[model samples]
Target: MDMFEDDTPGNAPEFTVSELSGAVKRVVEGEFAHVRVRGEIGRVSFPRSGHVYMDLKDDRSVIAGVIWKGVASRLETRPEEGLEVVVTGRLTTFPGQSKYQLVIEDMAPAGMGALMAMLEKRKQMLAAEGLFEASRKKPLPFLPEVIGVVTSPSGAVIRDILHRLRDRFPRKVLIWPVAVQGKTCAPEVARGIAGFNAMTPGGALPRPDLIIVARGGGSLEDLWGFNEEIVARAAAASEIPLISAVGHETDTTLIDFVSDRRAPTPTAAAELAVPVRGELLAWVAEQGARLTRAQTQAVETRGRWLRDLSRALPRPETLTEGPKQRLDYLSDRLPNALRGLAQRRRVTLSERGALRPALLRGRLAEEGRRLEALSARLRPALDRAVTAKREALGYRSDRLSLRPISRDLARQKGDLAETLARLSRAGEADLRRRRDRLGAAERMRETLGYKATLRRGYVLVHDGEGQLLRSRDAAAAASGLRLEFADGNLELGEMPARPVEEGGDPAASKAPTPQKPAAKAPRKPAKDEPPSGQGSLF
Candidate 1:
């Protein structure tokens, strides 16, 4: 029978385009509801809706395929042109285009060996471009004020990282949530790294001093996103120091090679970002003590030198004593010497007058004239002698005077004393400053100690084996436990039950103010409980 032949006008079968298309869709979709197809991808395209459309083809046949946005986002590896892959999806028909296609739910490389080869090839290509060069790597910051984290927020990886950071040194963490292992992981992580670098420093949003791209331990297929070239390039080009912590210590990814630092795990990455506050404080205190000691020793040495120099210097009175004695002797002898000279001249004149009257008169006149001339010359000679002696005495007096020496010595002593005073003042000031710093550091250390926290109404619960309890479950399971209060400890048989109130509201049961524990006799252990070791609360 001819199926399309119209036998009669009234009895002819008719159908709308929608009815025909719906029938075809049902038949095609039912036949290939669930199937796996192996082919090389071709002409892959993404539209505004994020759906991936592509052609899957072999030498002899071709088929159209699509991955919806939600499913496409979850793919571990994205589809690439000419790449052989195995895709699992359901076959469906689009009524508008009158075509049949596979709606891909999942995809993977055709083989593990093929994927490895591709990864190695990509690594080689990136290496050739100097992306993995040692010179390209930047040094990680010793202390980062703001740390940027790229990871999945819902995963345990971020929580582990934050906990580790808090334990070491608390820092501001900016979390950029992204897929850690999927088709979108590479692009999202790359964007996150670049976004941190693009932020302006000291702006409304603090720029990260360090970036950590982290993911938990995963299989090679699951970690492949971190090995993508895009992620590697982004890490290499980051202005801020980048740390790649993609998997466990044994795992290595391409981004690890390109990053400035590679941490064995996400927690280790957080450790690398900042220094421990306690250790840093200890170091500062040590340095301050050393400085104070050095300055004090220097001041003491200088003071000793000044004392020795002062003892070696001559006194002003000792230097002037000789000149003063000579002046006194010269003053006492001058008048007696002049008197003896005048008496001898008078005796000579009397002897000449008694010789003759006429002749004596003439002789007396000549003698008187000669005596007068001699007297004139003698007086000048005496005066010159006195003047020469006076000048010599004056010269000696000037040379012996203590004023010049005292002035010079005083100036030198004043300068030395001033210098010493300044040095002493400076050393004392520096010592005081260093001591203050050391004290402050000690206070800070005490403040940050766990004992201080315990005093604030917190307690430390330890098991019978001396292991600290971290959770309520662990505390409940222990056979015997020690409860540490601020002042002392108590041995308990088991975890204490919470006290209830009449209203059944937990908040209504108020705890009494903490007080010093009173001394008490040791209680005998219960039948099921083990004896606990006794220790100080601290």
Candidate 2:
């Protein structure tokens, strides 16, 4: 019956044990506003309302736990019986049932189990999303101008990426620095990727040819951000080809599953970013050697062809029948019949001996005569042959000139007319573009016009030659001029004269004021840098 004291065990108070338990719970609840309990889950139940009911137990005792529907639905993994759990909750007593229960705000399985459960849950979720599919992966571009990197700013991952990309091909690499761990990290990583995309000139992001999302080697928990659904979705949704390098060769993540390519390490990711510089150089050198060898081969082939051609052709003088005819007659006449042959031989021998002198004299005289005749005939024949050949060549050249080098020039003319028409159409299109640009410019000018401000209240004045008079010095001697106000413009009348003592008197002067000899303005130098404008002549 006493509030603070215990009575004898057998001769107990009239109140039930449940009543006492409820009373004790109420007292403890009033004493402690919030409490954290570590225990093993005894039993678990989920209801249609989305609430979770579980009993938290120790070796000797247990207490009821009520997880609200909203919080229960958000848990990555469901509570199971016999699992050790840590719960932050408030205690309250139910007076009607004379029982005590905990209303849990947040809960988690204790130690390694919690992490393993989370990892397994994430793996299942991403798997269900088909993030691991190979069909979704895109091909990496051969050459890229800008490559986006999502990683820690100060880490070796970024430095490795930069060095690798520069080594492979010197191109710009944009970095999207992000938090890679803790509760807020997944969202931050996701947002960083989106931010990189948003900075592009078009609605599309800079669209780096490749995205290298990398981090140094770490334990499974340390690389957990890459396993998050947010990060996985971000990688999957990226337009750029993504290479995920989350952990060591043994470790993998959901981001790796969704990425276009996966590398075992951060350095390997860099390797994926660009080709090896030494290999490229070696390839270029090999190509150069091949080209040189090819050229050398071509030259040798041409030289051999020339030698063969020289061997195959005959000399020019041997081409006609003049030498062959004389040789043939000598061969034929020397072998004739016997009787005639003897007489012919004797006569031929004597005759040949005697006739040699006469023949030489005759030949000399005939040669001289022939020479004289040739000399006499040479000028006219040469002139005639030359004139005939020249005339023939001229006629042929004229005929060739008259022939149409280009087939159907009339048709070409018609085609040219059509082309001109097409060009005219193209010119009209260009003119329309220019006109659009002019209209846009005019609209912009109107939009930014100072005249609008001038209409509010403004004035502009000009001298005789329409030069804007900016200062009182310009207005000093100027008389005939115009002034424009917001409303309208008016021409100015003759101004009053200056005092004679100040300079020259106007009205009292008898002769017309000698016009101050106007200084001739200097001529602009000609921009006659020759031949630079010719497109191909230079």
Best by lDDT: 1
Query: In angstroms, how far off is 471's CA in candidate 1?
Result: 62
lDDT of 1 by residue, 436-457 (tens): 9999999997787766777799
Which segments of model 2 are wrong by more than 4 Å?
Answer: 1-28, 31-33, 37-85, 92-102, 166-168, 197-205, 295-538
What CA RMSD would you report for each candidate? 25.6, 22.4
Deviation in Å, model 1, residue 519 alpha carbon = 56
Candidate 1 has an lDDT of 0.82
Q: Give all candidates' CA lDDT scores.
A: 0.82, 0.70
Model 2 clash count equals 0
TM-score, each model? 0.48, 0.44
lDDT of 1 at 301: 80
Quickly count the clashes in candidate 1: 0
